[model samples]
Target chain A: MGEKVLMKGNEAVAEAAIRAGCRLYFAYPITPQSELIEYMSRMMPKVNGTFVQAESEIAAINMVYGAAGCGKRVMTSSSSPGISLKMEGISYIAGAELPAVIINVQRGGPGLGDIQPAQGDYFQATKGGGHGDYRLIVLAPSTVQEFADMAGSAFELADKYRNPVMILSDGLLGQMMEPVDFKPHKTEEELEELGKQHYDWCMHPNEDEPNHHHHEINSLEIDPLVLEKHVIHLGEKYDEIEKNEIRYEEYNISDDNDVLVVAFGTAARIVKSAIDELQEEGKSVGMIRPITVWPYPYKAIADRITSKIKKVVVFELNLGQMVEDVKLAVNGKIPVEFLGKVGGILFTPEEAKTKILENI
Target chain B: MEVIAQRPKSLRDIQFTYCPGCTHGISHRLIAESIDELGLRNKMMGVAPVGCSVFAYKFFNFDMAEAAHGRAPALATGMKRARPEMHVFTYQGDGDLAAIGTAEIIHAANRGEHISVFFVNNAIYGMTGGQMAPTTLPGMKTSTSPYGRDEKDIGYPITACEMLSSLKAPYFIERVSLLSPKEIIKAKKVVKKSLQFNKENRGFTFVEFVSTCPTNWGLDPIKARDWARENMFPYFPVKNFRDKSLNGGE
Candidate 1:
């Protein structure tokens, strides 16, 4: 076991990112996520890394794009409105197939909705917000432990798929503190080796060979035929990701359960508490918590659901954003219901239990 | 045998897609020639902004990244900071550096990031077909401004050199022209100096070229050159606004 430290979700994620070999970070100050950038500013200089507090979110995302192109492990974080400002650069990074990590500590949105936690950015994260046929490997973490843990895995998956990875946590998680055991960090020698692995494509120049030439990180494909092929190739990669990277946690899911609950991020944590209370009362309620929201554990949901289950309830802090995915997974096999608390107001376990009882 | 000018090895054999009478070709050759003269072919990195120069990655033999419009300076800042050993620069057009990317250019210059910027101000959006640019002249008739630009409605063209020179951080800032042979000779010297300063790790350097776009301007190549000299030179006034070396580079 690693050393356990009580840490806020934001700072833990930032520290874990440094441990995972992120030597460069760029960000603009936004509510609920400022701790991450502040922590980075102090620690990065100590480790001889860089932390650039950019003028705006647009500039910050572009800086990540530039640093990532040079084969550096880089990151940036923002809230809902700031992520909207970063959309163009995000799309370009995904289109260029450069590896980067973006943390969207989600707050209320659609237009600076509020400073509190909300899962309103679900569709934007999973469906590729910016223009183009691309996908972000979105990880929805419900606990500070998972939030910190996803930092390392996020960079690993980004490099493995050559795509952007998003840590989509909400403000509650960002501000809350919990004891988390961190993973072992990458050494400077390991990071040096990682740089050598990207020699074929990084922007730091390359030797010209029969099949090799100068490196370029670009998203512009003027030729339609060439672009079509590139999009198809991206689709193939997503298909492989869906096959290999579906992560979820099943709680009290058995044949005896009549109600199945689906949720992710902060809402999932609430759902788990509600299910535990309901189970104590002898009510058969189970929960399925999605870890990878983009590759979304559809098979896990489909597999656990049987004729014995009478209702599938989806809960969120937004106006029914993730319920659509739950319905798509349920596929008319059972009645799917939604319960939402909007405007950044969080629902407690007791409130969630009431809603679960009403829906059933 | 009398030796004629041959293409620089720093430029790839790819043909430029620039329109006739466009000064992008001339500007590219100047950059390419400077790269060859300094022996920086393998150590050079560039960021191409989204404009007529978006495909600049295809012309230069060195590694490059295509940035979101006006985001080239931000990208170059990242590259130079990450790999301080490499020489980094950005090639941007008017609509890119002045219009959509105004904030990016200003902040990057203010930070004094160690990178060079080559800005081409042709007063119109060339790739998107003759729209009004922030550098567009008053009374100029572009596709968007068919009845001539109104300085009252839309403000006058920004003089980037003058604006950037006011900042305390920049190491060098110059506005040059490409209208005539004499201007081109002087412009080459400035471009070479920017590249040299970059190699020396001298801080943020910017060189703006008041260029011509005959296709967008609805003029012949020679007439476009004449129009630029008459209109652009008066407003932009080819001059060096700031150079650290002017005072022995403190």
Candidate 2:
């Protein structure tokens, strides 16, 4: 393990990405995530990497598309409104089937929302925020350390699937500081190997490999039949991803539990505290934290629905997003409920415990 | 028997989809020839915009990327910055570059990104049918302006070369015409020089081709060229706007 260092969540993500062999970083300044772009700006030059403060979020995402099309590991970051501006380019990246990473340190929003942490973009992130049939392997991290770890995982998943991956963080994680031990940075040879992984399709002169020429990195298939085949092919890949990559943490789960609390990210951390307090009171309550929100760990949730569990409750910063997923998992087997705080308001641990007690 | 003319090595053997007399074919040939002459066939990469040349990726024999409308410059910026050793260029039409992508083009030029831009100003959106364009001349009839473009309501055409040359970063900025054989010969030189400068890693080269759209113009190919010469030539006058090399490049 590398020596531990104190780093902000945003900064840790940036450092972890560099260690993961990302040499091309582009982004526009947005609140809560500005530190990430700032960190890249200061460090990219030192590592002989490129950092561009793009003119707009739209430009930054397209720049990511351009670089990733060339088989280089690239990243961009923004808050909510900025992310909305990036959806168009993100869709293009997905359609082109290029590996790129986007960090959305979410702020509250439907429009010009406040610069406070919020989980309102859950639907946008998990349900293919952009247009058309596609999915970004979305990773949700509950702690700063996990935020740092997920950076490496996000890039790997993106490259493996040849799809865009989003590290869905929020204002709390971005602003919080934590001690993180990043993995060893990739050596020059390893980075070179990473670069060559996409040589078969990357946009290059192909001078050394003569038979490969005119590799077109594009999403537009003019014929409807061809496009249908392509979309179905993408669906098959997504199925493979769902099969192999669903991740979640089951905490205090037992057959004696009366309530199965479902939450993620910040809400999950608060829920963990609530479960701890409940256990002290001789009350049996459990919690499930989803690490991958899209593949969703639905089967995991469904399998844990014991007869002793009277209800499944969901906690979120938004009104009720992930609750729907929990309901789908519970599938009428037990009563499902939702508790949330919006507009940047977070449910306190005491408040979470009270909610869980009421459900129990 | 000696071969008089052949397709450039940089161009694929497939037939062009351009309509008869449309200058996009000529422009593509010039670009392909430039890539061939400079021996950048293996090194050059192109970004095709979302217009008539949207299929340019199919015709070019090198690695290519098709960008979202008006976002080609931004994509080129990403590619060039990621791999500075490789040469990149964007092919955009009037609607894609001047109207929708104005910000991307201007900002990319302002940053002096090391990429070549080939702007085709045909004065109308061809693929989407005849609609008024940012480069559409005043009092010129288009589908969007069936009664001729009204100067009061629509405003005059944008001279891309003049506007881009206003920036300090571009190393070469020139507007060329392809209405006649002699003019096309001149345009070829500009295209080659632009690519050469790009190959040399000179920053931000731009070339605007004042071209003809015979199908949309409701004229035969020859008449369309004549009309462009009579109208567009006066508004978007052919000229060399900027050459930083001539003044000792930074």
Candidate 3:
């Protein structure tokens, strides 16, 4: 039986990371996500784990890069602006094919926007924030419970693919309190076994075993041919991920429904609330929430679109990023409406309901 | 069966990539020797910084992670925390640690992370063709600071040992030079002690070695040593800034 306790989304992420055998956590204190780092700081000591308040987001991300390079489960948390500072290291981690978890408890911004919840970083998180042809497995958690659950799944996916996985939540998810049950903790021995099976590229100590070779973890290759080859290999891995890891949730989509609301993260939560109100008022409205933003539940959305859904509305906290993907999914069969607020203004359930009614 | 007067067992047979007269080789040997002496060869992991020592992972036989410039301390913090049973350290150069990664190193020390940091301050960015580094003396000229580093424009050289010593959490902080053979011996002792502290699961230990860049300084190896002593030492003095062990009137 799973035990449930009331916890904030940020606290649940921290607790789940610990339970998933994450012993190294480094982060800089930023609003919204500060609670996550604070929780880790208080909890890491009790579990014989380590929590470091890094000097900056750049430092924190690099710290994750280091721990990941050594075949250890590690994580770092930040808001939008802080995550921006970490882009360089994130690109490096992706290039080196290191498995690490990065949590972006997104707040507003192209700059120091605001502390309010915003999904403006969707393009950045899903489309590679840094300069590279790399894709992070971006997970969007609609509820506090999923935030806890995804922490373990994120680590598992990272280790499996040797790629960085980002939990792309917004300030609402980071700040909201809800019931959550922590996963069972994995023993050190179990983690060691897992690490050995997956991370042969890791820098484990080379002693006694003469056949053991040193591994150099670097993302640099001046040779264009070699770089092209490396990128191709990464491309193949991405394709494999796309085929195997697409996840999404369809809520109340049926042949009777005409307008379909598309959303993710916090926007999805608002959309769900709107859907309930719309259904109560005798309006046919439904929502589709994309859990994995990169592997992007395209198939599910396309399947729904084929079943007589006419109008689609994409709601986001950005000017229009995820709408493009929605359009691609709809393939001109339906008109895609975009309702967005940039620089940290979140859409309210009433506002979404109003938009849905107008569209209908 | 006693192993003495020989190289550390922790070090591999790989030849160092550092240029001749580069103090990084000596510094690396000192760290490896310390790891060996403490019987931490098998349990030690190191984060190698970018710049001249970027390829340090190839030199160290133990597990090593290569980090971007200035991020070594942050990386070391993660590794040390993730596997407390393993000893962790970061080998960094002036440009990597003092310039870009200043925040990471300072905060990690301030947090009193159970890791050792071996900082090599050569006064110039050697790997990147003699760019002026944070540790470069005020009047020193480099590729970037062609008109000699003007204090008014570039600010004064950062004395890392002095800076870190001011932090409360760091347990050991020392500035040593590797100019002469005698100084090399002293530098090795400091490096060893810092590693030993980490092996003993003590708090943050920092050893700043006043290193040299013969190729970048456009000086021959001997002249570079002489130049470092005449110019760099006066600005960045070599001394023990803090030692928790010496707090008791020893």
Candidate 4:
């Protein structure tokens, strides 16, 4: 109902989820993303939604699986280790073809490495956190507005694809405050209509209708041929998503640019500041931000490489995870260089500029 | 043509893969009968766990979900919450419930999630070939406990009914044996009662069937039944641990 309000990225995500008709939320409190869960806990009941503070991250994700299977817009939030704990459930949800949203306000990890902000979960979120041949629709939000907007988009994509969608934000975005607009909320009527979308596949024990078959939500395929066919079917779905859903944002990538900087989320924000300083100093530098981390905007980055641009620079808050994607995108068209800050350390805009300047 | 004994409409027309004399088929029939008798066929949703009864979803004519290991309770919780209008239940075995899924079962019961749980306690892991379960009787020999279950090394068999009874949120908790015709009749009543409670949207309800694993127990069907009756009934007594309806809630 609010036209404009100053909100934290985490809170904005929670508010956006509520507006998008996320009626069921399950979570266990984790650092950097605690506000999201707390906001859901407070707001869900008021809106006649269910909020469960589950026993563990494992339990929370499973609860998401349950609600999603029942054709409810469900979500869960957690930090790095918590997300790792949820991998098993996530794999199951993916295998079962359930639509749900997971917010990983990532922090330092490799095993509870630290509580500070980091982008170390790039591989986990995009490639596969769980043990299956699966991919989540990964969205990386750099601003509070994007954080809020992506929550709505996440549900849409998830429902459209019948897959899990993740908001892969770092602690910086989660903790930082910015003005956000919460409008165009899914109305009560719209929400009711949305609930009807999954009626065909959702678990409804409609024993009265003789023609209606039992909707069994399971991933186990016993026969080898059947399992292979199922996996191929899922692969086809992912291929469709890949063909349709690649999203990114480009800044100042005109012909004058000698080097292109590729980044995402908080790293992109820092990279933007660095690019600004570089441009002011008469350097040809631009930034390409991949908003959707999964469908990693390879073409967007690749298409920008002109005769003048000789190299691609990737700066991330992790230890060169997305750089691999950048390199693959470049495909030897130009050399790809990586600059990273790990262990909860965020490189300053000046430090990033220094790296870019040295690279050139 | 008199139909004194026929498959319940809630059951699919398929032969069970269970070992001859295994109580899973009987238990499935009783549950199906209850669903039919209660007229809950259209609204019944079942979650089958990873054990001998993992294929329970296939046997049950109603809509069902297959969960990993002991996560059936968690899966059922999601189903019940998302669609409260549908009656949901989880069918789990001893290893899946008493051991690996201890947390899920306990917490779901504690939260008073509107779901019924059918726990089959047969002391051994039937699906995985006689591995020792948490409900394995002390001194009982299982594949994992070749030398017999040592209480010091691994705690004594957990009594599921007794454990769940301690939780205040649960509306009903009962344990029954499936060793004989008489006991089977009693177990059926408990199953029906649990389902009835679930139909009313009463909080968490549970029924533990003290069953036999003839193949896993390396005994004839009759011998396995006798063994369970002699060894397990005394430990996991057949009775309701908590009935909030009678006492008018906790």
Candidate 5:
């Protein structure tokens, strides 16, 4: 922690990216995530990084694909409708095994829903939004500080796996301002070390070398057998990711609890408030707040289930997307219930409390 | 046994997958020769479009990326912006450039991004079985335009060089033909000049090669060239639209 300063979540992510030595930023203007791109536009020039306001979201993500192919730490941010346009490029990036970070500052949507907070992109982020057998290591941050921190963490995860990582945030998180402590900027030498990590496979000039080799950043494999093998190799990586990267926060979880609540992102924050009130009223409720929603903390939710726990309940901003994950985790051992609000509205703690009590 | 001409150092020894008599082979040779002639072979990176030239990554003996349909310019923009010191270019077909990727090509040129774009206009989509392309002639018949293209329905052919040159930023824009031996010789100079401009960091160099799709056009190699000269040349005339260097004072 260097110093605590007040910052919007979107601006904090931009600052964190710059501090983490991400110099290539390409994006289009969208409502909830515009501040992220706007911050990069103003700051990238000062740091001598490249920033382009691309023609559209599709172009922006493909630009990310190009930069990432060269082993440059690149990022693009978009809202929901804009993100739909980017799926084609994201699929290519995943198939090419390039390391890139995407920030989806989600607005409400099936299509251009509204410029308000919603967790509707949960399926789009964790499951494949793009056409492929791939997953984006999704980090759902509940607070501005976590949102800022996940920027650096997302880059690390992307590089570690040589896959794309998405920081799934929503309008409420993007617009909210809170105190945040950013890590120190990476030194010149550290940035150089990071750049070298992918040189063995990345596209770069090897002209002067005795053995000049070429690198192709491509995803098209016409041969079905070869593609099958490649997909299986990707599967192995996903398995490794699943084994090592499942992360969640357990709040007041114990055997004595009557009901277990599952939620993530901003919904989890509201649920925590509801749990606090429930405890005050002599009712015990615990929450499992998933941080990494892809290698979803399924076992964590399962292991915490004691005989005393009556039922499991899920709360979300969307019309019950994560509830499916909750049901899969519960595995029919316990009854699972869900309560959700859609169309850019967030359920209040009182509403959450009533839902939890109903499940109890 | 003196070797007067051998393969260009910038191209691999592997065989091309293009259909017999397709001008993609000619276009690849010209680009490879241009990179080799400029001595930028080692520092060059190319982007392959999602068309007949999608396997261009395998053909070009350098760093390359294959972009999605109509998105090669955007990909090249990213590559150039990432490695400003390294030379970058995109090899795109008419459908990839003029049709699906109109936004990307226009914006890349308008921004004067430091990259070269080689647009191959054969007037039809050869990879997807001769469908009508944005550069298809008004009355040209193809798989999609079975009854000949109607201007009211499909619209006129896009002259990419003219459209791109109208922008205030591109440093070079030229359209050349590979319809005949003499035209090919002329096309090579334009290709080399575009790469030279790229090497010199002259912004957004573009050259559209009026190429032939012999197999798709149901013509033999010789007749395809003759057909292109007769049918394609009038609509997509070979000309230099803009050259910043010729502007005298910038």
Candidate 6:
């Protein structure tokens, strides 16, 4: 176990990735996420690893694709617009069933939106941003500590499922400072053994073996029937993940509570602060923070949304994108309200508290 | 011993779904032969770009990755850096590399990633039913350029070798023709040497193979080769734009 240290959220993510056995990092510098790339560039050389400043966001994602193909632990980081540029590569990685870690320190969007913190990319992260029938396991972190801890879990899930894993945070998480306890690093030998066992599709030379046959890594199938079969297999895997990997946290949700606040990532942090304030003011309000956005804890919300809960408020940085999922989870048994900010501006705890009070 | 006529040892035995006379088969064979000769069959990982070659993952016997169009070079960069012990390369077409992937290729070369690039220039989009390509010569007719490629409107062809040679980081840049037996022989040598350089841990290497599209060009295979040699070659000339080995020898 490494000593606990105070670090910014972006810095913690970079440190956590290094500790998780990731050595190959390719990224292009984008605001909000620049510190993560810079940290890797400095640390990789010291660790005898490789860090490359890619030409563009497109190149960075593709480089990640290449590294992942070789059965190595790899990662990349970028801001909102840059992550949008990476969507095509992200789709390919998911389609090919390759394990890779991608971090999106989200900012305002729509087109070069803003460098400020925003959760506007919730839909793009959970939904298939690129063209295809595929899903990336989206992990949303609300605190710096969660940001550090989830990096290892993200890589583990990526390898376990042979899929892409995204750490969906925002500029506030990237910029804010907090305490973090570093995880133990996996040894090179351990990683090599893991790669050998799990990365059967990787390109390692077959030597002194006549029975060894060639393996291909591709996502193209011209025939509709063949493509459909492949898609069905992926769907089965996604279902399995949904059953096993759904994660969330409930704070002070009781039968007596009349309002439930649902949020994720940075918005959840603000919502938590708001909940604290409302509780101080003696209001019956509770919060639910989603940790995994894709394999959402829908059943948990549904089970809790009994007749006692009068309303559910969905707060995000986007224009009511995640509100749709919240409505589905609540099943319209109660009214759903939305409070959102767009183009990179983040909602404050004070603002959330005001919205909750207004609903009450 | 009876010789078996099949795919090369470096290539999987899976039958390619390419149309008859499609140059992708020839290009794949050349690449496989190069890997086999260089004894890099085990250490080689290929990045397959979108377009017709999206299934390049199925053909190569080595470990392969499928990348979105124009992103193969970027993927190759990451793969090579992650596993420097392995040789990384990307197989891309004109549309994937020259058009949509233009930014990827330029930066990969500029960064001097220790990888090789096998760029197949067939002028027209083969997978998408003959659309206009960035390397499509002016005045050439295609589904998208039905009125012919107007230089005043669509711009002239992009010479990848010449464009890449301008980058100081690249160690080698060559443009070869794959239309004739002699040209095929020459192209194979270029391909082999590039892989050898990769095995030696040389810097970025790029090879552009000017190929033919008989079906897309609405011509016979023989005429397609002839048309390419006469039309495409003059515009996108065939030659070694840069070679560290040649410079060292000199």
Q: Candidate 1: lDDT of A269?
A: 92
True contacts kept of each: 0.72, 0.92, 0.66, 0.75, 0.85, 0.85
- Candidate 3: segments with Cα more than 4 A from true spot: A1-3, A185-199, A204-206, A211-213, A222-225, A276-283, A357-360, B1-9, B13-15, B247-250
**On residues B91-152, what C-alpha lDDT tens digit does candidate 1 reach at each position?**
99988998788888999999999999999999999999999999999999999999899999
The digit string of per-residue lDDT tens for model 3 on B1-250 reads: 9865776666778787788888888888888877877778777888888898887887887777878778888777777766677888888888888998888888889989999988889899988899999888887889999999999998999889888888898989999999889998998888888887887877999988887889999889999999998988898899988888775711
Query: Which digits, one per residue and each the tens of the lDDT, describe model 4 over residues B68-146?
Result: 7888888888888888889999999988998888989999999999999999999999887889999999999998899
Error of 1 at B155 (Å): 1.1
lDDT of each: 0.90, 0.92, 0.86, 0.89, 0.92, 0.86
Task: Supply every candidate's count of residue pairs whose N, Cα or C atoms clash at under 3 angstroms.
Answer: 0, 0, 0, 1, 0, 9
Q: What fraction of native interface contacts does model 1 preserve?
A: 0.72
Off by over 4 Å in 1: A206-212, B1-4
Residue pairs clashing, model 5: none
Chain A alone, TM-score per model: 0.97, 0.98, 0.96, 0.98, 0.98, 0.97
For candidate 6 chain B, which ten residues in a row score worst on lDDT? B241-250
Candidate 1: docking tier: medium
Name the TM-score of candidate 5.
Answer: 0.99
The true-versus-predicted C-alpha distance at residue A302 of model 6, in Å, is 1.7
lDDT of 1: 0.90
Candidate 6 local lDDT, residue A136: 93
- The pairs that clash in candidate 3 are none
Over the stretch B130-224, how does candidate 5's per-residue lDDT look in tens digits? 99999888888899999998999868999999898789999999999887788889999999998888898979899999989988888899998
Tens-place lDDT digits, model 3, residues A85-171: 999999999999999999999988879988999998989999888988999999999999999999999999998899999999989
Task: Show where candidate 6 strays beyond 4 Å.
Answer: A1-3, B1-7, B19-22
Q: Which 10-residue window in model 5 chain B sums to the lowest lDDT? A: B241-250
Residue range B200-250, candidate 6, lDDT tens digits: 988999999998888899999888888988898788889988888774631
Off by over 4 Å in 5: B247-249
lDDT per residue for candidate 6 within A115-194, as digits (tens), equals 99998888899988998899999999999999999999999999999899999999999999998988788788877776
Quote model 2's TM-score: 0.98
Number of clashing residue pairs, candidate 4? 1
What would the DockQ be for model 2?
0.82
